[model samples]
Target: MTDTPHTGGCRCGAVRFSAAAAPHHVSYCHCVDCRRASGAPVSAFVGFAADSVSFEGEAPRRHENGPVARSFCASCGSPIAYADSRLAADIWIMLGAMDQPAAYKPTHHAWVREQLPYVHMPDSLPRHVKSSVPRPTE
Candidate 1:
């Protein structure tokens, strides 16, 4: 987090956005949904106050999967973010989209039970079979 804002956009440059404040929480999700959505072993994201983020150009293409709604770039099919409609005020931006991904630090590993055995867990993070506490902020 810095006085300077964080900014990023879709790979095709069809979509652009900015965040005025540092992200609140960052994490790597190993849930099946995230794995399928990202086409990777895990999906890394940075959570920000919804009001602090803004978008430009084309809005992300959205997909509803159970309780989660994911956004992606239509042009490049890049995973953008996941917004839980239930918590309309928060947005989880994909870490890969950040211009400064090193600034993103994952706090926890979610859905540990479903994580691939080959995927090693960092002892530093608190691993949970699922979110132990209800994420009111989503």
Candidate 2:
């Protein structure tokens, strides 16, 4: 955490959010659900504890599917965040929505078993078929 927060907003600027503390997890997801929702080959995220994050402007619309619930901006249909019941206290905000996307470098690749064949990332980061987030300690 620092005096200057990590900030970002929706495409339409209808939704804005900020994280005050350090992120718990930063990774790339290559699952089908993430690819379809983001309309991209892969999706990257930076996770912060729920208490350290605050949203302003319009509330994001949510899509719930079993244990997962994704939030997006209603105005421009931009993905905002991803939440899973398994990680109840953390919110994974899409890297694409971050004002400083370059600052958050993904440390690993998740759902590698479900990754598309043509999509390749040659980085030596750890790969997890089904990841158990190594929750960071304060």
Candidate 3:
């Protein structure tokens, strides 16, 4: 909401990052990849332009799976971020890691096909079958 840069770090404080601009999007993802990466039924992320974000403190441990690169706090094992090569212009940070988690509220659901049957979200947002990113016209 405010222009003050959004900041956050890992649970152990070994990894810190700052997002200088407002998040472009915030959403929950139910894809299997997200479930595995986050160790939760679903994952929430706040996205910012790649150029506006920077990382500091201890170097993060990274895992590469297909097009997605996930980073975790090397010291505490807290999930740091999710970056997908297909969406090179943006980087998604774990919503749980934000300093002010309530400031950025998720607006949609993604990867609904992989959503667990028991998970029920408020029926106010659009749900995407896969990614919300619009694919390029062929």
Candidate 4:
């Protein structure tokens, strides 16, 4: 992990967070859950070890859907993070919430099979039909 820290917050500045270590993974997700939670065609995230992150100010409200828990800012309704118990040590933070979103480099795409027909995505990155943690039979 590099010495530099990653910092971010909600759109309304009601919630803030930081990561002290390098991200384990950075990728885009096209799952229906992610798209619905973010209100976008696709969601991009950076995964960091749970222990490496710190939250401050008003805590975001959480909504659990099965094994996944999504946290969002109550003040501005911006999605903050996604946590899946299957990846216990990892928490994926929404790239849009980052202070430096331009610095993010997505490595791959997850849940590509559910991607919307109208959403045009880059072809250079690897695309996973399902999550690596557990393949959902559709």
Pick by lDDT: which candidate is best?
A: 3
lDDT of 4 at 111: 92
List TM-score per model, in order: 0.90, 0.92, 0.94, 0.91
Q: Highest TM-score, which number?
A: 3
Model 2 lDDT on a 0 to 1 scale: 0.89
Q: Worst lDDT window (10 residues) for model 4?
A: 129-138
- Tens digits of per-residue lDDT, candidate 4, 1-138, equal 354458899999999999988888889999998888888999999889999999999999999988789999999998999998777788999999988887778889999999899999757988889863452443
Kindly indicate the candidate among 1 and 4 with the higher TM-score.
Answer: 4
What would you estimate as the lDDT of candidate 1?
A: 0.84
Candidate 1, backbone clash total: 0
lDDT of each: 0.84, 0.89, 0.90, 0.87
> Model 1, poorest ten-residue lDDT window?
129-138
User: What is candidate 2's lDDT per residue for 1-138, written digit by digit as tens?
Assistant: 344358998999999999989887889999899999999999999999988999999999999997789999999999999998877899999998998888889999998998999997999999999653753333
Writing each residue's lDDT as its tens digit, candidate 3 over 1-138 gives 565459999999999999888999899999998898889999999999999999998988999987779999989999989988878899999999999998888999999999999999867899999887664433
> Which rank order by lDDT, best down to worst?
3, 2, 4, 1
Instruction: Evaluate candidate 4 by giving its C-alpha RMSD to the native, one decimal.
Output: 2.5
Query: Per-residue lDDT for 65 in model 3?
Result: 84
lDDT, model 1, position 79? 87
Candidate 1 vs candidate 4, lDDT winner: 4
